[model samples]
Target: MILNSSLLVSIEKHFCGNELLNGEMYMEGIKHYLIDMDGVILQGTKLIPGAAEFIQRLRTKGASFLILTNNSRYILRDLQVRLHDLGLEVPQEAIFTSALATAQFLHTQRPGGKAYVLGEAGLTTALHDIGYILTDQKPEYVVLGETTTYSFERITRAIRFVMAGARFITTNPDVTGPGEGGIVPATGAVAALISAATGAKPYFIGKPNPLMMRTALRTLDAHSEDSVIIGDRMDTDIVSGIESGLQTILVLTGVTTREQVERFPYRPTWIHKSVADIEVEG
Candidate 1:
């Protein structure tokens, strides 16, 4: 059955009321939350103030949540360790990445196609885990994700392969990601650069793409009315949550600032400066 647009708008307006009233959310009850990593939970290497405690509170109240990220350079296990180190108790299955979504998409569609991957161990491992073979030896597809070892040679090779009729795929289109040394180039930048060179557009698998969100909902077995998606970016997080039929909360700790939000065409259901400012009462 098709969902109603007016219902979505009403849900959005209700959530936005929390932002208008400043930091407090007094809804009926929320059962699940999909949270972002870099900006909403932590800025760079440090945890966002009170995020760990907020998560602990959610857990104490028996709420279901997942950590969703557009970053594809790290796998679920990697993110689990990182969040644990930051004092947030997150399970491996509760972590979802664009890489995982891309891998899932590839598994259902291509099955066992040979792929030329221009990414780090994360993307390679994801492809391998999904039974896709990795090869630079005339592959059927060119996969782009974040790689610290990105070289001009690698980009040139990817472009050459795509130009030779290889299909292209990407994890997400985030131009940059927040890191310890300020912002660094993300997988999307590399994809754009290669797309420009090869004259072939790549299909994105993360944020704003419903695959990951659908997977998350299935994993959690939760409905849209009982859940909310929180993140720092608008194009990725806000758009994804809105499209996925969930309430949206934009935290201003990482990429998009308050002024930038005003300039954007879309708006989140709620906006907060940091997770520290969000207090959910039982």
Candidate 2:
């Protein structure tokens, strides 16, 4: 279902205001695609239309890709199961998470370090897998991640640890996330509270940081000039990709709408309706 080059140009002219793009990805096609999860492929536990097809297209072209998600609540296996139940066959290894990135960064900085964790199994297990000890007894770091079960007891403990000279780190800086009822405070919100109490700012490890993108890109052995990042958020996904020197595609199927694009000072290399509108040829 690849659209003709002329049709692609027309869409770009209307949305991008340029018939030709200004990146290495123009006409050459993408070698690797760093795709977002919640908004691009899935929407509230359901697979978006054309998600599976887009994945299949990539596989058929022998392209490299990764499912990059900022949600540190679930591990790779958990994500695979969720996507599997939703009719997508994404492999566990193909998923890159903020928890994993944070763990990797910490491991590289201080091997076998200890931390006071505030998150779910995803974050805990990532630290565990890296051979890092998790404890609240005057640890070396105070790591915060996405957790639905936020308790005042834990928040106070995190603040105390940070105040006691433990370095503060967070998974991402997203202040809000979609909850069952509506928008609810996420890791960023909780991190702010801890920061306010301890007078300590946290080092964020996820999108818009560019470190996460570089790590993920290195994992795939993909070069930035020939890669593309597709996402729904203008703040995290698009900015991260642009900063990391990769072409960015802002898809409308997720959190960001077409109108919201004008608000951001930066623009993605391309804007498509969805993954369905993007096709690659080898």
Highest-scoring model, lDDT: 2
Off by over 4 Å in 2: 1-19, 22-29
- For every model shown, what is its TM-score relative to the native structure? 0.87, 0.91
Task: Give a tens-digit lDDT track for model 2, residues 171-255.
Answer: 9999999999899999999999998998999999999899999999988999887788899999999888877777788899888
lDDT against true structure, model 1: 0.81
lDDT of each residue in 97-173, candidate 1, tens digit only: 77888888898888988999988777888899989999999999999888677899989999999999999999888
Model 1 deviation from native, Cα RMSD in Å: 3.1
* Maximum-TM-score candidate: 2
Given candidate 2, what's the lDDT at residue 13? 39
Task: State each model's CA lDDT, in order.
Answer: 0.81, 0.88
Residue 83, model 2: lDDT of 92
